[model samples]
Target: MSRTMIAALVLVGLGLLTGCATSKDELMPTNGMTMQELWQQGSSMSAGDAGQQNIAATRATLRRPITSADMVEEQTRYTREAANEIHSQFSRLPNPDLVIYIYPHLAGRDQSVPVPGYSTVFPLYQKPHYAMPGETARPPGRTR
Candidate 1:
């Protein structure tokens, strides 16, 4: 009975492993088909037509071109709004310090490519400005 149970467990484990171990060909459902071929295949085959249609619609929506005038107008509006907010914030604060950090590209290698499972961002240190001449306000404590 013990041997039969062990064999049954081994067979089940093997079945699970087999399901996960797929070849590249199996992973790529389109195989060697071009865009036109894929469209044609999807149109002919009813199996994945709904999914294909959804993907096509999503791609079409994503490919929409934004006009330069629209982009400039959005940029100007955002800038004005941000400036107004900053002005309001500064008016309330006793002292304000504006600092910008410019990170130059590393000597070699692409900065666009992300380090897998890890952030490529560098640490930022900012010195807080004091309000009074003699008295200094206590720094905000770090919170988890």
Candidate 2:
């Protein structure tokens, strides 16, 4: 290495060491607590030291009786009519159901009892379609 490069590196190392150093005045407490008092407080703190009474007081403060306004808010949040309004704010386009009726027929070779007729329904599309803004409020056919 050259002389100038080595001298510059030494100066930079010394500058970094000085930047990391702290004075005794800066370490002293500004909150009127002396070093001796701080040492005593630190020595008193142990593994079993816990503010259990403080926790109980906080819990008691938070556990105040619920007001009627709170009950009203909860009612609005959970009621079926409000629930539909909340969930269906973006009105969904109606997907008509396709009902297929199965006729009664005999089944099984050994026990050939007649199978009752039944109907099952499936949505017209694979997924429910949603309407755009200002679109029809209700399904196509019905009024009101």
Each model's backbone clash number: 0, 0
TM-score of each: 0.25, 0.33
Which ten contiguous residues of candidate 2 have the minimum total lDDT?
Answer: 46-55
**Position 94, candidate 1: lDDT:** 34
- Candidate 1 stretches with Cα past 4 Å from truth are 1-47, 78-144
Model 2 global lDDT (CA atoms, 0 to 1)? 0.74
Model 1: per-residue Cα lDDT over 17-129, one tens digit each: 99889877778776678899878886777548797888898899999899999899888755746555543333322334445554554333655653334225432424433
lDDT of each: 0.60, 0.74
Top TM-score model: 2
Runs in model 2 deviating more than 4 A are 27-32, 35-63, 81-144
